[model samples]
Target: MMQNHEEHDHHENGSELSEMQLRVRALETVLAEKGYIDPAAIDVIIEAYETKVGPHNGARVVAKAWSDPVFKQALLANASEAIVALGLMNRVGDHLIAVENTPRQHNMIVCTLCSCYPWEVLGLPPVWYKSAPYRSRAVNDPRGVLADFGVALPADTAIRVWDSTAETRFMVLPMRPAGTEGWSEERLATLVTRDSMVGTGLPKNPKDA
Candidate 1:
């Protein structure tokens, strides 16, 4: 009975969101399939939303992980369980693995076959994420791909690519920005962006936010 009640509540709370996601996904898919959009234009739109607008739930998750060490440990250990346990997601379809950005390594996500995204946290995948060139280049030429996104990592930082399959998706836990010490989770979430969680960009510096 409790499980059924939870399902009922989840559907009531999230049905509209799910529907809109479907509509948006359908529209973007149709446009991309018809060759009506340019990949560069798509990148610009994503940039405009950086820090200013984004998947709030994902940002919140990122902030919580940043502020809480125990939670971060669990999140890095098992993203699907951690997110669901936090009440941020009712379920995680398939497996959701999380990779963290560190001084020695930067993690990026790609779905070479298709756009297998963690819609529960990050919302719909961006157009650039689904493009053919991005899928091919993210693995073969990661540095060049980051350059196109205007991201310049340190020469010593190794870029690690996590490929998403139909049954497994991934998210990036970006390094917390400096000058954010003692900041509230709410304040820190403002620094998280969709691209940062995807690994194409970094969280907003505290000053920038």
Candidate 2:
């Protein structure tokens, strides 16, 4: 069976894409053609950097914080400044906040109004993050939302949901897992996941990684 000319170029398979995503794809196609880049490679590049598909920058921050106490303190006190020092600042937002998770408490972020995220750290916000259901449920039933992501916190640990505004954005600094005590920052960063910083998942255990 031979594919039609139109079908050969079409990527969507009866799936609906938001107008923004569609526009991004259009722009991506134009740029790739102009630069003589492969279209498939474009998707991988966008997923790794443009979209919130990877923990490239935030993983470094989380890993460093886990290894360096002084840096951790500075990051907690002023996220925007700390990341800027590491040259990770990329116009994420007007303000950036780092929230730490502890044995007694967990922090989750949500933009009830819109998706205001630390793009440089976490890449862009995920589609789900911008959805009405997530924006509403994240605040109303944070534990349930975490559960949906397969993260079950201890009953004793309190869950705190932070609402992100256009002027401010928040990122979760998940507690380091045990058995990773002596891990190097590079190795530890491999354990950090995009969802962990988003507050919906935990870093991978050393054994798992």
How accurate locally, in lDDT, is each candidate? 0.79, 0.78
Q: Candidate 2 on 9-106: residue-level lDDT in tens?
A: 22233434459968977987888879877887864675575554433489999999999999999999998888878776544455789999999888
Give model 1 RMSD, 1 decimal.
10.6
Candidate 1, position 19, lDDT = 75
- Poorly placed runs, candidate 2 (over 4 Å): 1-55, 90-92, 112-115
TM-score, every prediction: 0.74, 0.73
Which residue pairs collide in model 2, if any? none
Per-residue lDDT of candidate 1, residues 142-175 (tens digit): 7888899899988888887777666678899999
